[model samples]
Target chain A: MFEAYLTLMVFGVVSVGFAVASLIGAWLLRPRVPDPIKATTYECGVEAVGSTEIKTNFRFYVVALLFVIFDVEALFVIPWAVSAKTMDIGFVVGEMMVFLAVLFAGLMYAWKKGALVWD
Target chain B: MSETNRENVKNSGEDSQGSAQAPVPGVAKPSIPAAAHAKPAAAAARPAAKPAAPAEVLPEPRLNNGRGRLLGSARLWPTEVWPNPWARPSFVRGAYWLAGIVAGVLLLGWSVGEISVWANLAYDWAMNLLRLRQVPELWAQGAWSAVKVVVVFHLVALAPLFLVWWERKISAHMQSRLGPMYVGGFHGWAQTIADGIKLMLKEDVSPRAADAWIHLLAPIVAAAPAVLAFAPVYFGSGLTAADIDIGVLYIFAVSGMTVIGIVMAGWGSGNKFSLLGGLRAGAQLVSYELPRTFSVIPVILLVGSLNLTAINDFQSGYWLGFIPRWFIFYPVMGQIAFVIFLIASVAETNRIPFDIPEAESELVAGFHTEYSGMKFSLFFFAEYAYVFLSSALVATFFLGGGNAPLPFLRIWPSWLWFFAKTGLIAFCFLWFRWTFPRFRVDRLMDFNWKFLLPWSFANIAFGAVYLFL
Candidate 1:
């Protein structure tokens, strides 16, 4: 176990060493000639003008919100899932059928509301 | 200053002129050692290693990624610059030295520790061999364990450059062009190494408005975990990182943290482009993370344990002589889980068709836009490393982790078989990277939520019912 730890440390150090060495090696060799034009971010051939903080479109957050809610709800269902088969087959089967039905109901609700649409 | 400027311009222009002439085009035969000659020749010609050549004359690698549409514009992929805003000219070298030592020590110490454990294990097993009349198959486990450490980590460590080379080769072939045919024998195999040396020689800049510490830490943050995540995956036949109980979970958590690093990288750079890129990545990873985790849940449920080793044990044998017992072959939920996991895994890694975070088009190389030098390379390498890691993981979770593909081939040994499987999956990853165009941010999020999440949950329902039946 200790050996594993040691190996990891050595690996980490070597990898990081390579990363830093490359950065520094290049730094030492490359010229540092910064100008207003040179320093600006490249956006195709156009020059960078000002801060890039234009307001984002609202579409992203709405879809993201729906994604999170649905995604999380799925996590909650996992424990119930694994143990389902060995339980009373009818009760278990019926319960999941209803569970999925309710879940789909909400999804249908969202779909009708146009919340998932990107455009 | 005037003398230095003249030297910079003359030497720098000379270097740039060199690389353009020898790029390996398509249909390459294995290369002869031309770079071997050029390195010594170039160095001898510029022995002084003059500091900071003029920017215009500096030899920048003008890459033709391929003749494809993505390759044509992918120059939009993030190029780094130096003389950053957060730097004071006088303190630069000192900063590099200090930062280098701290990072180097931590990483080296950790890797050495992992290796030492295997060495000790081998010693103990060898000493006990005379007393314990062991079967060779059982004893082979130890040897396999040791190989696992080296091949999984070392191969994974090095494979990215090859994959990048392969990507170039593939795109070149697809576009009816030549790939890297020069440097490092017969292919542009040495190109990545050369590029590595070049980047090291390059300077890192902390943009003027950037938060200095985060700017410095972002690449490290993005990259270090990419390497660390390799701890859980064993590349050999029957080997792994000492079989962590939370093996798959360990992968999930560590891989997830890469997003945090990416966000830090983007936000710290203080570029609008970088910030937007960071946000896209943050949003993308966080959004997909749920489905990705959910995909694994079914397999865990079926296996009845979180331990990757235990999971592998369960899947190792064939039910009959003809039937392989890999978990993906389980009933409907198992099949759904497999599909969900593959798609979600790809998205979680922020691969092509899902790479909105670093979307080159709208975001302009997105996060780390201001980063240059080795810092930039970290992000690039980490992308490939994580891709390999994820593919290995998917192979582990669904297909038998170290089982041979043919039922009869089990006689050949396990670790080799494991590597072969993981390697094939990894190639598929690179194939996908070159083959597809990226998904739009909105479309990407929608797919994860609408498609993957629901499918996984549906799989969950099927799993619950199957468990009862």
Candidate 2:
């Protein structure tokens, strides 16, 4: 088990190292000319007019909240799905049906409330 | 020169008057002519005016119609008059096509057995040489594993370079145009390499107001997940880097991290367009991931294992004497799941018709708008790499990883079949990209939630019934 994780760790390190090395190599070869006009933010060739630190739409916050809920649901579903074949089919299926029913209700509620509507 | 100078002065004077009405900086700056240097007195008189406009201004002559015709005609040649290779007789093209088909079939047959024989011979030769030395068992095992890691990393890194060029060529052909025709000989094979070199030498520029550390870190984060996702991908039988028990789960967990990198890029760029692009990417990825994950559940339930190799093994033989028993042939449920998985995979990779994150017409290069040089190339590499990875997974799960289509005609190595299937899927990705227009953001979200999500869930329920029956 530890060996498997070590392999993953090594792979991650090597890949990140490769990314850093290539960036450094490019930095060495690239020209370093900087002008104030060039460094300014690009807004289709117009000078940027206002601050970028403004609040976003509330729809995004709702999506983020839904994502957290669904992601945790997936965590519950995967383990059950993996072991579903080994356990008692009637009991396991009943439990999963209940779990999915609750989630389905939540989805339907969101749909009814117009939360899923893009506009 | 004097005539053009006078015309440019007239143009600038008109532009300044127009600017006084609108006062837009970008439009107002470009109309100033370089002839202002000739008249130092005018410049000195207007010294109190905006000093920034005239610093790098140059005169640009608007071409007249006759001059345009002359320049255009100089470059145009009649197709019939030019002695070109494509203008040859019809039979010549027919013979070339016939020759190519014959060569491809012959190569496929040779690749079936000869390549594996040579590879085994090389392995044996290396082992024999090692036996002559006093190497310890643990040391040998450690060294071999290290070699495997390095080889897999190279495949993960370099495959994208070739795939990028391949996508360009495929897209160009689909649109009836030539792409990168002159870079490195036959069909611009070395075009990506040339592009890599050029990107390396390009100036790395960042916005003055951008978050410096996150701007630099975003590409690394974007690219790292792609590399990590390659860990559990089985190239062939007994040929995976790490055949962990939960291989499929590992792939999903790691690939999800790429969204964070994209979000970082958006937040760090200090551009509103970048921020919008990044948020779109995050939302799109999250929405599509549900269907993608659910689509895989049917396959998992059928195979009763989360291990990718086990899943491949379960789909090894045929159902009937003639038909292969791949999951894709599992009747109604399998076909529906495969379609859902494929569509979700395309969305996950951000290909056309689903590419709202980097919709060039709207967002101007999207989240990576402020990146240049190597940083931008890293994003490009990650995107193509994900395309390749997803295509490979599609082939592995549905098309039978490294397995021959028919049982009796197993001439080629399994890895060759794996690659051929992956290439077919990758070509389909390019086909979709070129054939379809991008989706509107609302429609893109609607398609995922309304259609794909419900269908994926239905597939799982259908699979359960099929299994019990």
Candidate 3:
């Protein structure tokens, strides 16, 4: 158990080390040509249309809601698939059919409600 | 003078290759410029190789594009170690990939023999348990042996080294180009060694405004859980530090420590970027943890025990002619639990799509933003360690901890089977990390709380009903 603590400590140092190493490596390999114009925060291609502090789009909420829907469904489905491969095909198939039916029902509702339709 | 002359020759030779650097912005392509990036036309267009090669030189740095090399970096660490290796083009990336494959193959091969010994031991233990017979001495020897302690620790640390290499290799191969080939003959297996030395020599820099105590302690706190989380996992079988009654609880509870370390680092750094990264990480880990815990609840309910060693024992034999011992196979609630656990576990560990806290693009390297040298490496190791730790947990529970995937392969003992399965799952974690992009923060959080949490709760209800009936 004590050894484990040391091992974890070593892991902590090593991972950070590699990340830092890669960063250092890139810094050296990359050419440095920073200028005053380039140093400021970017606003797409247009010159700083305003200060770099404008809030991001509110549409981000819509994306979040959509991601939640897909993510939850995947969680429900993945174990069924992994375990299905190991079980009797009949039982696995039957459960999958029911599972898919439920999934489809929800998906259909979402589709009808236009939640699935991303513009 | 020689380097300058070489540079001039290389610069001239690169005139044709100059177009190779055409800016596509947000696109990645292979550097097989001599060939084309996965072009079927180029494959057929191959003329008989020019018998005499042109003496044109090319810059070495351009050769290793999109490797595990940190993006937007200046060689602060690598430059100190292999001044030339980092500076010039070398097949280092390809070498690293090959090395990982070789190491994986070696581990796979070693386990094949070792698992048989492990299986024998597991059979002995399970029989003792089943018959209610106690070899009190044997059980004590198994748990408290000094050799076991050291070996398990090495196993935990070594897994991540291979994992990081494997991640780079997997990513490079997926993106197409050899990964870390130059570091060793087969591939850059030695790349990790070079990397290790480089990191060791790096000056541990603390940000001026950073809280010295917490800043230093944060990395240790973050990394500790990853190592401790492995204590309950069977290495071969019949081999764990302490087979406590609360092993599953141990995994969940210990794994949670990583979030604390990250938060510490973020708060200590005294930077908004770091703080935001820490907050995101904290929220992400906490949200997923409940779902991650519940996802596995169905399985524990079915298994009726949290003893990982015992769990693997249950999975060792064939139910019918083809049944394997693992839980994922032919399960009632186990199947549902397996799926929920796998995804939630991935999110819980803060892997891709769930890695918004450390979102490099927006957060500027996230929680460890101001960290450098070994301190930074500690956080990096913890991230991968968490990946391994959670995968280890996933392997133990719904997938039958360490049991072989196939019933026919049960000639080996359960212990060996367990590690093999755990290692494979760990590989999958690495595989997924390399393949996916970071999830948006709000999307990452909402998915865990809204979707995963509800489904896990539903799974819990269903499992309870199934068990009751």
Go through the candidates in order and give the clash count of each.
64, 1, 50
Model 2 Cα lDDT, one tens digit per residue, A1-119: 45455567677877788888889999999999989899999999988988788898888787778777877887777777788888886677677777877887787788788878886
Q: For residues A80-114, what per-residue lDDT tens digits would candidate 3 score against the true structure?
A: 53354345655655565576567557655755775
Across B1-469, the per-residue lDDT of candidate 2 in tens digits comes to 1222334445566443332233333434334455544554334124224334322233343445436432234323222253765666644775787699767865775555544455457657766666678676555545555656788899888889889898888888777666776676666889999999999999999998799999999999999889888888878776677778898889989998999999999989999999999999999988888888888888887777788888888878877677888889888888998898889889988879798999999999899999999999999988999999998999999999988899876766677778788989988988898888888998888888778876776777777765566
From the highest DockQ down, the ranking of the candidates is 2, 1, 3
Model 3 lDDT per residue over B409-447, tens place: 655555655656777888788777777877766566556
Better of 1 and 2 by lDDT: 2
TM-score of 3: 0.61
Interface RMSD of 3: 10.6
TM-score of candidate 2 to 2 decimals: 0.82
Clashes counted in candidate 1 amount to 64
Give the CAPRI rating of model 3. Answer: incorrect
Give the CA lDDT, 0 to 100, for residue B132 in model 3.
Answer: 75
Q: Which of candidates 1 and 3 is the stronger one according to DockQ?
A: 1
Output the lDDT of residue B26, model 1. 38
